[model samples]
Target: SSDLSDEDKIDQKGIRNSPYFKPDWSPELLSNGNYITHFCVYKNNVIEELKGFRGDYSGSQDYDLVLRATDKERKIEHISKILYGWRQILGSAALSTSSKPYAYNVAITALEDKIKRNGYDGKVQQITDTFFYRTKYEYGNPTVSIIMPVLEDLEILKKCILSIKKNTTHKSYEIIIVDHLHKKKELESILGNNCTIIKFDEKYQNSKVYNSGARVANGEYLLFLDPNLEIITNNWIESMLEVGFISKVGAVGCLLFNNNGQIYHAGKILGLDGICSNALEGRKHDNMYFGIANAIRNCSAVSGKCIMIKKNVFDSIDGWDENLFQYFNDVDLCLRIYESGYRVAYTPYVKLQKQNQITDDFSNEIDQRKLFIKKWKHVLEKPDPYYNENLSHVNGGYFLTSSPPLPRLMTLLLEVYYERIDLQTQFPEVAEGDYSNLLKWVINEGIINDSYMVTLAPFDKDFEILLQKYSQ
Candidate 1:
């Protein structure tokens, strides 16, 4: 903007511009952000290539400009609010309006060029998905073979593949599609140069298809994906790859979106409300980084829809248990990974939009009460998973404990049931005496409340500080 001459401004003003100019925004007004801005728009031409642009993108010129500006050495004021609106009117040249195949061609060229430009020592040919940017020394990028299980949906699967071929930042990868019962002609026509199709005779089961793909995969890392999802960004592979490289992270997953473009899965909580619920079930993209197409975080488990695992980790864990057909396959994998002493992460950054999503499909009304009781029968049993009587309510660490929901609830219900049964009849000593101590511990820890430990008791100052810090 500083390069514009006074004469040029005057000429534009004379042509059609208004006399009044917008006030220069102050740095203070933009501070103390109540909201996070999606991205800052830089003043630059879309088609013209700027000098010193870190990466080359014939089509994503605007994107490169914005990225460059964001990484500049200035106190780039975070416009603590949505400052501008880019109005793409109907029939305008919106990016998606372009022909899909043409866009794919442009995106592929730009991606390969960028990858080669940013790759380790310019060795683009060998760069794998697992090779995130390393600062210390260049480590050998172990080849990662990704096995995607394809069903009969050729169109959705094609979009997924095109998205990857165009946007993927890592190139040292192959797509092996285990077409477990699909039309031969459609599958053959769509399989690209970089992908292979394996036909299986049996009926389609997700775990079995993935296991079949892993048997002949030649990469150092293995990535599994469901075909009904579209890859959205270049960072998808790299994001999971970085997480997978961490010693603690056994598996990595991305956020899933419903057809409406709202969030479906950020990650699943292991034990919440008697069963695991995918966190952030229905949240809108306020243009913040958290719900963006590719924000990464540590999570309980990656969804089976899309997951990345190191080859060694996969083998050591004995791969997917074909016993788990589909629904809990991902959960079983995560639990196995944890049991094998590895962490499961949920990165919101990487994104895939689920196709044929039943986002609003809760039409059938099932028995809510009966279902709830049956689900928590494990918790009603003997040993509680999270009911530590020793730890005070002030302790904030119970959420991370290994107590699965069912057993914990089962233990509580039995204790209360037995206590009430003995109240009327002179029954045996049925109530577990330890329940009092455990209840007290749960109450004090703030899991449950009791009248016994009211504010009437004097508290230690040291204890107060410790509790406050943890609680906060």
Candidate 2:
């Protein structure tokens, strides 16, 4: 913006994606901060009716105006085109909130005012070291059912329960441990007065285990967690409830970290490396990669473990899918909620340290994965709406993609189409990969098995990114 010239405006897009800007217009988006002011237009009547701005909150006047305007209406849409540029000069708010510390409290005031106007008993607190804010609500201190699934690892459960009891500030929550192997008396000995136990026999890990736990849930919200996680954030439930209370959000998840304090699950990304996986695992738990780690944004899915959902929403989905015996059940649940017209959100406001997961065999998960792909291929075959198509899953980090979406898809199609054919020398410049072999193998598979996965996974997310990019 300092170089707001015609040529510079043309090149403004260079710093436009990731860690700088992403297009989100939901009330949840504005609740954290304003993304609607730069190079934006509004109806004169709307602005006038909202009473332009107050000099009292001069440092964050733009943010105040944005909150007031958006608070009036949530039916908003994004144009998905770059029309603004903000300069990150010294002593300017654009260089992060530290540039003008006064703006921080002003933004909180604006947010709390909006929350108060909405008839919610909530308080907004800024996330330290970042510009983002998190809202925590009382709602008369509703009980939250903490449903955790575990094996016979009583030691892990004990450590986790003790941590929860120590760290959690919200007292009105119950812990329901759904055990596959019987450990009732032992579980009772370790847990506190509010704890309940549910026993079940399941051969493999999946969301179905939560069904029995849900039946016994006495709380207004259901918190599905893994027994292996050590609770870190004191306000985990309140943070989740803040987002879940939003009428449009079905579920909320938080930043789950390995013992090393690295990100384990912030959310789920569909079609990463031809499979669905946790979001931003490559980044440290607190690393502000494009501000994604802290911001509460809609995700394609959040981890079923460490996810919280309203009891009503959980029942509406008929609970977790029982068909999934092992993998991707969490994603299936979130996507089903998404299909039913609700958003899944991820927040870093609540942090938990999970025991390191040792996936000795990626091959064993393939069967459940194929089933997951078949069941939710519609969503999988399209680019994740929450994940930016311009960002890539290379080297397991969300870095800028080497190429744009369209060309990437075209190149893949050419690769698959050219894999078996003797066309490599014909197109000397074309990049080569295993795409044609995959297509051919899939075709042969369809011929042999008659009609399923071969056709299901051929285009994969490459076509997904292409369609989403061009369609938008």
Candidate 3:
């Protein structure tokens, strides 16, 4: 059913009447939970297989059926056109999700069943509302070694340590502070007998320092944290440990907030700006997008600033790439973890405040980015499965791209032509064919102007001509 108002219906066609109503009901998308509300079609056989909708879940019977139908390995089609009419009524379940509380309860059971069927060792818990839910993994209490790489910022480090001591509810955790050079007596006195400070004379390399701390870490889990972080959530360590101890989870990260309460680190997405940074940085930590910001979910990579990994999993990966000293070492390690068939998870429950900002030299960042790109070019080229393809790659925060591609041959041709660095370079995969004459004509005439004014007649005619050639 369309949620559009009367004004929306008059000014712009409602979703039911819009031409752009086609949706891809891929298994991956369905597994993340359904976002669509109406215009569903199902085969008689699939209906029979599901044994029809359960009468117990009267309000969400259709949703229950949909979940059950998707659970099986069967083909599901999304009709581009809305073929059914959804009459609006006073007490329609579509309009009022709260009318029937039993439906929401049953829905939770359905989702939990799906999780169990999928063989994931996690339980579903309702979020703020019963309509939305999140998964919580069950991992026994394991000793966690919190590794903090610190420089000379004693004040910030002291606050960080104090916050951990005061706020953290999780016991059986040890703090291993890797001191670089500025090992002050005050810092030692502050640490006292609580933390084991490892002094290193080598120049500051984030990866090397973490590796050094891990070498002496006796805990089952290794938590790599920055000295600037102040623990905000009481069960922060437990939250991270729960996800980290999952057999299939290689690494788990927490949501970090800046002084202004803006999101500092909330997992990460690879292939963004050649290297990777925090996904959805600068957004309010609680601002939910498709239930992502509010739930525990899998990601391609996560920030190392407050990430935890099982000791064995860390050892298996041989620790962080020291070559990627200052930057992208975390992303690289997470990528390796992904390649090794373990998922990287991010949970918003464990929130932390980062007091100090870690600034990197511009030139050094560029160099690090180049190294990261060179090593993971193939992964960069591929779409991040955890992230939506429609989202812009240029922005770390998931935003819709301006001037999205039109489903026209000329638009594709223009895109391919623009992608080419030089005339000699091969065209994009979409425009890969022998169009020597068209290329020559385009090169000679330059159909696309410097200011990108598309006089479409020439390109359109050339595309048709090429289409005719390819058709033969």
Candidate 4:
């Protein structure tokens, strides 16, 4: 048992929800290493291996030590239990980050050194004035062809093009707009001398329109964008290119927000209601749950509204499924891209604005969804590698489900059994002597259906008491 003062116990509640306690810590986790600085306990032997901390980095000595201690072979394990507490005394650096601003700089240095040691080709930069940092992957500049599909909304198209021209910092790019159906002179005027507008005199299909644009694209990469989108981040193109140019990455997507600043698309998760839905839809752009909304991670699919892929990769996949036409073509294309041995990644650094509308013609959308399910039935049956099993498929977001824990329940049972067997442990016996039955009852009643309940179950007193009681 560790000493936890009254104040420490109060602070531990907040720390438990942070990214530091996230389940795994791999090389990718280390690359984005700013979150692991607080409430950590390093072994005496591991500290000795790092030859103690440098006095020069006194303010961020713990951060430096943790970085040196964990490597690819010897990674850090995050225990959900709070075994220790941090006391924030007056004038202590922990009490106030402003007390020693030098620590921030040293922390950045430590991250840079760690990246070098791990052979990660990236640059670390402080995110605004905050202690949080972002790692930008470095790859040579490649010309990108932006393929935008539009109907006849010239005003919206003009805004989208203007935003891209004004906000985009990447220089090596060309815009190719696929004109579908209505041919407005305003669209031609909006195209100006910069863009190449191609006419498609056929039925409106997003996949075919994009494929038509891709055929004439000369750039090394293809950026499929919706003309209704307003670019929010100046570095959007640069950020997408950084991830898209990677050999292992098939496609990269940015966070998309509606006009009201609510999330429209963060990433696409498959098997949600037997089709694909945007991960973290209708949430704030910065809502950090399991660090999925904020961190760079692989996903099965991303919204084609604003996704980038290598020109060759698109060609290899034979472009999108023309049969999908309008809805779920992005999902179909992304799944094929994944099957073709390439990872699809979503990054929060680049964000865009668009007004998304769920189609009222449910029958047509449902028909397209059926075609999608028919094609990828095998994938829907399996667990999504990018998403956790505990998360719900009932909704688009990563909400927890009422499904029984199965293997996870076995681990929880072992923990409860060991606690009861330990004589010195303060752990109370099941109030009614049958903990297994209580767990079963709780699952049956749907008490642990959501993520909030599951996360707090181990520490929540009422929850623990409920688990201890036997059901009728």
Clashes per model (N, Cα, C within 3 A): 25, 3, 0, 0
> In the order shown, what is each candidate's alpha-carbon RMSD?
17.2, 5.8, 8.9, 11.4
User: Per-residue lDDT of 1-472 in model 4, one digit per residue for the tens?
Assistant: 1111111222323452221223233233334444444556666766677797888777777778777776434535444334444444455554554766787788888877886886767777866534556767676678889998884556777888899988877878899988886665657777765588888888777888999999999889999998778898888888887667656678988888877888888888664543457887877756455456777667788999899998888999899889988778888888999889887888787889984453434446545755665577567645565555555654455665455332322333333334334421322444324455545434554235633224224323343444544343
Tens digits of per-residue lDDT for model 2, 212-291: 89999999889988888888878777778778887778999988887776677777776554456777785665455547
State every prediction's TM-score relative to the real structure: 0.50, 0.80, 0.71, 0.66
What is the RMSD, in Å, between candidate 1 and the native fold over all Cα?
17.2
lDDT of model 2 at residue 10?
Answer: 20
lDDT of 3 by residue, 129-217 (tens): 53565556556667889999775768888898899888877768899988787575667788865589888789888899999999999
User: By descending lDDT, how would the candidates be arranged?
Assistant: 2, 4, 3, 1
The candidate that achieves the highest lDDT relative to the unseen native structure: 2
Q: Each prediction's Cα lDDT score?
A: 0.50, 0.68, 0.66, 0.66
What is the alpha-carbon lDDT of model 2 when measured against the actual structure?
Answer: 0.68
Better model by lDDT, 1 or 4? 4
Candidate 1 Cα outliers beyond 4 Å, as residue runs: 1-139, 287-295, 358-472
Model 4's TM-score against the true structure = 0.66
| Candidate 3 ranges beyond 4 A from true positions | 1-13, 16-96, 111-124, 135-138, 182-185, 192-194, 286-288, 394-396, 405-472
TM-score of 2: 0.80
Can you write out model 1's per-residue Cα lDDT over 1-472, one digit (the tens) per residue? 2111010012312342111111122111111110112224344542243453444454444433433333323333222222343233343322123422332334334334443444422221211221111212133466778788765557888888888887776767888888766666787787767777777778776778898899888887888987778888665776667556654567877788877898777665543322344655566644332122233444555577888887888899989877655455676777678778776766655788877763432222122222333433343222212122221111111222232223334233233334344321432332432233333333355222422222212221223443343244
Ranking by TM-score: 2, 3, 4, 1
